[model samples]
Target chain A: MSGPTVLLTDAAPAKAASTRRSALLGGGGRALLGLLLPLLLAGAWEIAVASGFATGRLLPPPSRIGAALWSLAASGELWTHVAATLIRVGLGFAFGAGAGILFGALTATLPPLRWLLDPSLQALRAVPSLAWVPLFILWFGILETPKVALIAVGVFFPVYVGVAGAIASVDRKLVEVGRIFRLSPLALARRILLPAVLPATLTALRTGLGLGFLFVVAAELMGASEGLGYLLVDGQQFSKPDQILAAIISFAVVGKLADTALVTLTSPLVRWQDTARETL
Target chain B: MLSLQSLSKTYADGTRALEAIDLAVPNAEIVALIGGSGCGKTTLLRLVAGLDRPSAGRIALDGEPITGPHPGVGLVFQEPRLLPWLDVAANVGFGVSDLPRRERAERVAHALERVGLAEHAGRWPRELSGGQQQRVSIARAFVANPRVLLLDEPFSALDAFTRKDLHRHLLALWEEVRPTVLIVTHDVSEAVALADRAIVMRPKPGRLDESVALPLRRPRDPAAPASEAATRTILGALDRSLRPRDAARTPELAGGSSF
Candidate 1:
């Protein structure tokens, strides 16, 4: 038993190193595999257009969407729309996620506050993000205020739920350790509670960010111009399928990029956590 | 010195976990409370550490009554219980936060070095093996330089070899710091090996059954005849403590089986 245990323990580090190396080696191949299906769909669409099976004017071939993107970029229209949408998302996400974390922490820590707030907030969360569009437009008008506020409202619920749940579910044993050490309530929160809940909260923030884009699109659709949502509406009004496809594709790319950026930013904070992995 | 006077603990559900437990440990003495499951060994340790209040009695450290978690007491739970976010050095320094920064760092370093984990100061708790993590927990408990150290089956989770190694390490640390130590464990050999006195406890409204003094010299060998005899004595006491009062009157069971 001793001999085998020693051998197994000695092999563990080497096994971990090999696993890390394989992960690094497989990164590019995994990314390529992810892109394969989308590329196949685009190719098939292009072939169908070329074979005249679908009219290019109605469906817009891959080439036409690419050309639309190029022209939008060259004329600087793409940057304006992208920048407008991104600013709203950035501002709204900051406000919503910030408020969510604050209120969630308060409610989770204080039983009376939780009792007073959680039920109403949960009910409000059940209402669709679009339901607030007309009300926000009427209250704040068709300016960026309504759009940003709408996005904020959309971003708030998931983050609040995530943070509250995470804080409530922090390991009781760890909390006992803190109490045994005689940590002050504030010190306990700063040292134990915050770090324990961070991973789940970051995941919630990412979800909220995705929802931020969706709400911004809905908000922009109801009101006046100057966003990817505006470009999407403009394309429809002019009956240009290429422009519409261009806007939709850009949204998808931007959303993916934003999610990736968030993951990169949060990975280091939660590096100590033991995340689940797919076995090879 | 640490003293527990008539300490009793009764849950709200009308179950008595401990009853009139009385014990005392002079300064720098090592004592072990040995018992079976549901014998309130952990409850006694917790009460002594000021982590829980006794229902009907008092625990005093250096003649001061313990009302809540006090600086004079340091506790190492059965689990290492190191906060996952903190590195080894930070975990060691956790209980000693009132010290000056440089002093805290020095104490943490000294404790880690004493536990033979100096090089692991920057590693996370998860990166360490179970034994190493337990060592870190010992480091944390000792770094505070408390008047008393409470260990609740601290080595019971480790494999036999690691457990032996930690016993040696714990003895070394005790020799160096010489804090009054109360270790709660069910392992008879462990009590015989590390403790100056082993207090046998009985279950079902836990109470002290007997106390056995170990007169073996330092660097005691677990396989030695004296240690084996002591282990047998404690086991015999524990077994006798477990038998029903009426059974002791029966002729056939009067000469109970020896361990």
Candidate 2:
């Protein structure tokens, strides 16, 4: 708030240096504070196991969980389960996203299509994806088909709604400019509509990935033989807590990898957005 | 040449925009329609552009009845309205979608060079200054090589210096292209400086209030000694037209005024 004259004075450098030092020190203190709770929980868990209040078989120690992960890796069972889950999720997600984009675009561009489909879509989105698991199993049997169908249903609605809303909300001024230029309907959709809706659709893609995880776990819990989700449920049934903990860790790693893939794929399309928001 | 004969427009809510208006735009002449806000200046331009149909009357271009947007009419709106996703070159070439890819690229490049933005062809609208983006919009209209150019307050958003510079650029382009132009603006000085004929309009069942023939010398300088007198005369006429009916009787005007 002071004048530029004061900012340029001899004392300004010393004041600025002290401010920087204190801010760094404060951040270090907060980091240590954040670690205290996690450290205390780990310590108590180790103590409880030693005291025999909870047996190692029922509630495994952190070291036991780590050993279980290494053993699973050595046997190749962990990799096989992870690959199976990924294939199911990937195939289901690809089909769901493609269909969602086509239907969403069709509804947005044609008023008659929108009027016909909007009510049914609204009704479907009301039911949670898990609710469809039973019906999917009944229709397709307790095979891979049921699990894949559940994941697809879960992924579809968010992507469809996101793309449709983005298209419908496109700036009217841009459309007028298109008209002045005499852009054909296909050209207008490709150049004007698609680019405008891309940012929203990208966000929806991420949301669909998350829903795919939920449906995958639900499907595995009910019926499945060889997936990360099945491993977790199987470990629980056998009272082997170490195996369950290892499965959970692998699930988190898969999620992080999927997220990284999407981010890498769309980086070029969103370069403008990153530059615009650099100051913030 | 372009002509509007008894051209009229009424909105869906039945608000009449223009009525029984007649004007002839000869080849290579610039006509500026000046008016208070919502005096059907834009509506008239839209009607001429064939964006909206005239409720009554006819518009003709080059001896043919105009049923839709005239084939070679270039329109620049109040806002630059460039596509945010596109850079300068792409924005300029937007109106020439039918041209082959190679030809479109050549036209876009040429138009950008003409607008003095050859080096800025890769810059987005958000990346450029306001005046620069407006220039790209001007380039867009020019790239189409229109027979008649219609403008709606195209430079009203700019500062004085930018506006003046653009005025020069517009005139230079007009001289080269020799398109019949109709400009709608609220600034009286802008009208007097750019137009051979200025039409003043009034709102509330909007119609033409007055029309004046500008006598300022060719290639008129806005800062010249003669231009100041022209400015005041135009301003006085505008003041009389704007005044309440009771105060409009003391019309001490100097310019040739017609309706």
**Model 1 residue B236 CA deviation in Å:** 1.2
DockQ comparisons of all candidates to the true complex: 0.57, 0.40
Please give the range of 10 consecutive residues that has the lowest summed lDDT in model 2 chain A: A271-280
lDDT of 2 at B14: 90
Q: Is the docking of candidate 1 incorrect, acceptable, medium or high quality?
A: medium
**Residue B125 error for model 2, in Å?**
1.8
| Model 1 lDDT tens row, B161-182 | 9999999899899988899999
DockQ of 2: 0.40
lDDT per residue (tens digit) for residues B191-223 in model 2: 878987777766655666556777666799878
What residue runs in model 1 are displaced by over 4 Å at the alpha carbon?
A: A1-25, A275-280, B245-259
Query: TM-scores, in order shown?
Result: 0.90, 0.86
Residue-level lDDT for A172 in candidate 1: 89
State the interface C-alpha RMSD of candidate 2.
Answer: 2.2
TM-score of chain A of 2: 0.85
